[model samples]
Target: MSKPLRVGVAGLGVVGASLARLLQRQSEALASRTGRAIVVTAVSARDRARDRGLDLNGVAFFDDPRALAGSESIDVFVELMGGADGPAYDSVKAALNSGKPVVTANKALIAKHGLELARLAEEKGLAFAFESSVAGGVPIIKTLREGLAGNSIRRIYGILNGTCNYILSKMETDGLSFEECLKEAQRLGYAEADPTFDVGGFDTAHKLAILASLAFGTAIDAEAIHVEGIETITQDDLAAADELGFRIKLLGVAERTARGVEQRVHPTMVAKSTAIAQVMGVLNAVTIDADAVGELTLVGPGAGGDATASAVAADIVDIARGVAIQPFGRPAHMLEEVERIPMQRHEGGYYVRLMVVDRPGAMAAIATRMGERKISLESIMQKGGARLARRRTDPPPAEGAPETVRVVLITHATSEQAIREALDLALADGVVTQKPQVIRIERE
Candidate 1:
């Protein structure tokens, strides 16, 4: 067997500790599989005194992660430090400059600085692996970078964030409001106190950016992703989705279009019969649409100490086995600049929920507005009477004023421009009482 692959891990958090334990426990099996003994030789973290319950007996500890990254003792650097810049970025760069193979689970770092890092790795002919950066433990990265290499991928979409998924699934299953589910998620440790990063759709946007780059061989353009959170999703919308034979999920979608590659993270209405719709709770799912594979979905735990560590281990094993695949499936210079398709030009069916005054002319006015834009409606259903009006955030009706009712319209395939124009016209016509809820529908 070749010399043992010495590993230095920075950041002894949940994933870091889990990875150490896994490397220790699976050392023999991994060695037999990879033709090299993989060993953890050094580690760095903020609080060395913190009891992570891992035996770092023979491992050296570094006060500075950069020092560990550039250490002569380790052949590989595993960065579990979570950040797009600062230490995570600095340490990873240090390791690459020191001619070490790199593995990471930091999505933010990869999404933001992937190109630069990939260029460095490519120039050095070293592997830069980040299998755990997106959907944890699902191996979507390997599936895209290797398994589906022979096919032309048409689309890739998934429930990429577990915190958001947990909240959404909780809301749908228990009929709780968004806030209630969020609080529950926090209590369950699925969400942080400041949940904006995850709940506000930025987290999924980061993951989606990475996936889009791999699936399309495009440069990672996170800023180009059209993002929307599940903050506005309500029980009314969920109920309406059920009636329409659909389920609401926070999805990050990247696909080919005539204009360009379209990447979006939003609350989407997917048909219940689809594989993605069946994923619930904190589990993550990614569906790839390719010419050869047709449609494929991979579902598993999106986040957890063990699951993410498993992915990190897989990347380390590949490195140990002397696999040198490009970070984004293609050579860094070969990655094409993504032609970003604007959301307004997006073509899709839509679910438009309007809270309109309970009057005869209101429905007609809305229909006319849609008709003016040539938007075809699949169905128009009024949900409940005046007593069932008013959204959670809607102020109570003024005394003696006309009450409101929810009018949901499912439109046939149309451009986003047309839908926005129609909704704006309806609002101007004094038909829509509150801001309308418009969710893009994914038929598959």
Candidate 2:
């Protein structure tokens, strides 16, 4: 029998507990496959007395996560603590510096400080794995780092956030308002109480930034990606999208364009017939377009206790088997600085909903402005008897006999700058009553 590989888990939250249970349950199978027994020797969390619904009688418990990171009994550190710069960062760094392999499910940490951490881990010659960081349980990091390493990836995009997906799916399926869907999601434990990170698109941006680095062989640039949430998506916008044979999905897209790397997270319009459009509810899907492989899409649960833990456990098993790979699919020194493309240079179809005064020449004025910008409309719909409904303290539209008309336009591929300019002109011309809502159309 070979020696046992000792593993330490930090944070006994849902993910941590699931990881611990998996390590114990899959011990014999893992030992047979890896030629070593994987053991969970220690665990850490703030509230040690709280029942984790698992027996931790044999494992050592520590209040300070750093203690588990430096424990002599453990050979690998599994970080499930959910912060970017707190004890999670401190413990993972400590473990790597101590010459132990580290695996983490912290996407925020990986997205924000991945380059620095990769450099440090590579400098120490330790395995720094974060397969669970993006698209939970999908093994996307492994796919990009090894499975498709031969191809030159042109683009990587996906529906990365599950909370936003749940909200959008509910709005489209149930015809419920955004606020109503959000409240339901919160009650169902799909969204956080605040829900700012997931719904605001920052969470998806964080995951996409990491994927962009892996696909492009560049440094992680979370702050550079353009992000827009789905909070502003109204029932009218959903109806307009449905009428046009498209579904609205909050997508994080990273593409290698002629200008540079275009990384953005926004409400996107995908064709209803596409597979990505069918990936509804709380599921995530990532599509990679490589030079040789063409396009491949991986879809699965984005986040949950068991699914995320499975990914973390896979990383741990790989480490136990002595499978070593570069952090960003290449040597840290060889990774190039990402040249971020400006959002204005982005070319894509758009879904625009304009609240216009129902009168002659207003529609023509919009058409003229779009024509001036070289943006041709694919379809337009005018919703009648639609009035701006104010909730609580939100001020109503300025008093006018102006009949409310919702003009939805599906535009051909055009520069974002031109769209903004055209929208500005339409608003200034008094043709539009409110700021025109624009959603980018992604051709998958």
TM-score winner = 1
- Clashing pairs in model 1, backbone N/Cα/C closer than 3 A: none
True lDDT of residue 9, candidate 2 = 92
- How many residue pairs clash per model? 0, 0
Full-model lDDT for every candidate:
0.94, 0.89
lDDT tens digits, residue span 1-444, model 1: 899999999988989999999999999899999999999999999998888899888889999999999999999999998999999999999999999999999999999999999999999999999999998889999999999999999999999999998998999899999999999999999999999999999999999999999999999999999999999998999999999999999999999987889999999999999999999999999999999989999999999989999999999999998898999999999999998788999999999998898887878888888999999999999867877655657677899877889889999999999999999988888878778999999877
Candidate 2 ranges with C-alpha deviation above 4 Å: 384-399
Report how far residue 324 has shifted in candidate 2, in Å: 1.2
Worst 10 residues of 1 by lDDT: 386-395
lDDT score, candidate 2: 0.89
Candidate 1: which stretches are off by over 4 Å? 388-396
TM-score attained by model 2: 0.96
Per-prediction TM-score to the true structure, in the order listed: 0.98, 0.96
